[model samples]
Target: MINLAARDILHGWGKFLFTGIGLGLLIGTTLTMAGVFRGMVDDAQVLIDNSGADLWVVQQGTLGPYAEPSSIRDDVWRGIAGLPGVAETGNAAYLTIQMAHAGRESRVMIVGMDVDRPGRPGAPGYLTAGRPILHGHYEAIADERTGLQLGERVRLRRHEYTVVGLTRRMVSSSGDPMIFVSLKDAQEIQFLKDNDALVNERARTAANPAFNRPGVPGLLEAAQASSGQSRNVNAVLVRLEPGANPDAVAGEIQRWKRLTAYTREQMEDILVAKLIATSAKQIGMFLIILAVVTAAIIAFIIYTMTMAKLREIAVLKLIGAQNRTIAMMILQQALSLGLLGFLVGRASAGLWGPAFPKYVLLLPGDAIGGFMVVMVISALASVVAIRAALAIDPAEAIGG
Candidate 1:
């Protein structure tokens, strides 16, 4: 028997090929949506991994610093460091803000770590360029995504910092690039008030009779000076000893220290499951809508093609073509169009993935699943055209 599907497609190859390309662009957008979701997940995972902490110790009754605003006294790490199975503890302060650099503003997460002591939990895992922050006050190590080069100065609140080092893939759960500064600077930036506010605070403290009683001049000065500094940190990053159980250590910190401690796994759950849950749902809804639209387009295109060839279909019916054979031919054409679209979409996604501002991770598993979904949609969409072709009268060929 002659291949009816191939013959029909060859006869109108221009329309078929262009229609496939148009459908392919839509498929590419769908793939890109999936990639955006995947990138968010990867960004969250990278944040957890790059922290290099076995446990995160934050204020009691709160999630970690990334998910919530957690403030604990900087000295809390000293107590946590002495706990059993605690090899080392580092105080960390986190603040997300818009940072200005070289005539542009970028959203960045400023991390304050003990840069004086290398290999601390909160420090950048590695630097791709220059050197780490050695100075306590103004030196910074920034993720390359922030577009900061070596010796470039960026202001954070009250002080300017020189970008001494650059790192890769160091971002917050929200995909904001990270800038590492000294613990003291981070504390001041996150907790301290501006100069005018500081003056007003000092006057307010001085006006209070509690500190300004007769013959208590020194006492009032002490109160004013202490109120001007910030000794608070967002969280304490803890590294456990070899073979230490993270859960046990976290429990001890929660019980004795009266603070919230999260093990690595639990923290991952908070960041991935809780932090990005809404975004994931939005992406899922988009995928469903795109699938429906794709199915609709396939059905419309195939139905129109079938209608345009009613005379040919009638001729085939008059020439002893089985209904099963006619149905198979339509199905084949739908599948072929879908196959072409999928190939073009996959290639387009790869070519344009990096052009996106945020990360777009196109996984092979997603691609495979997408291919299967497209084929199924194509098969289902052919039903409308198949029914129309089958309902035609064979006598229409002779009359027309």
Candidate 2:
């Protein structure tokens, strides 16, 4: 017996091909959404990996450095360094702000790290160009995604920083490109008040009798000077000794230091689960909507195709064609359309994924899963058309 599905598709190849292409574009968008979600998870993992720390020490009772506002004295790392199983510790400050370039401003995550220790925790893992921050204040190591070239000057708050190095794929949990600066500069930028605010603050301090008692000479000047500096950091990054248990070290730090300590796994969970949770849910909703739309479109196409071939279906029935055979024909056509659409969508996603502003990681596993879902949706969508065809009266072949 002739293959009815193949014959019908070949007979109306143009319509079938175009319909598949349209459906494929929709599928492509769904696939791209999955990739975007995957990219976010990857970006979060990259952040944890690049920090080079086994644990993060933040302010007590708070998720710090990324998820929430956490401020502790910059000197906190000194005590954390002496903890057992701690091999190295670094003071890190994170401030997401707009940095001015030549004519426009770009939002970037300004990472303050211990510049004195090159290749330490919180420093850029690798440089694609130039060297790390050598000078104490103005030098920076920028992520390539920030559009900052090596030696380019970018202003951060009150100071101009020269991008001394460029690193690739160095981004924060929110996918913001990171610009690494000295810990002192980061602290100042993160916490220091503006010049006007500072002046007003000093005047308030001088006017307050409690702080500036006339009997205590030099007290007012000392208070004003101390108010101008920022000595706070967001978190302390701790590297553990080889083979040390991260949980054990984190527990010790939390118990002894009176601070919150997050192990690598805990930090990853916070970043993926809490930090980007809303975004992930939004993407998931989009995926669900897209799946519903795709199914509806497939069902409509199949139903229309079946209705148009009603007379043919009637004639087949009049010629003693079995209902199961007709059902198989429709099922095969739906599967073929779905297969075509999936191939087009997979290719489309790969082509345009890199052009997105943020990373889009298209994993092979996701593609496989998407393809399976599409085929299943296609089969289910054919039910309406199959039912319609099975209801046809054989007498209609001769009457019409």
TM-scores, all candidates, are: 0.95, 0.96
Clashing pairs in 2: none
lDDT per residue (tens digit) for residues 1-400 in model 2? 9999999999999999999999999999999999999999999999999998889999999989799988888898888888889999998999899877767777899999999978679998899999988889898999998888988988899888888999988898878899999998898888788989999999999899988886899989988988888788899999999988999988888999899999988998899999999999999999999999999999999999999999999999999999999999999999999999999999999999989878899999999999999999999999999999999999999993
RMSD of 1: 1.6
How do the residues 94-154 of candidate 1 rate in per-residue lDDT, one tens digit apiece? 9999988778888999999997689989999999999978778899999999999988888
Clashing pairs in 1: none
Worst 10 residues of 2 by lDDT: 98-107
lDDT of 1 at 211: 92
Best by TM-score: 2
Range of the 10 consecutive residues with the lowest summed lDDT in candidate 1: 186-195
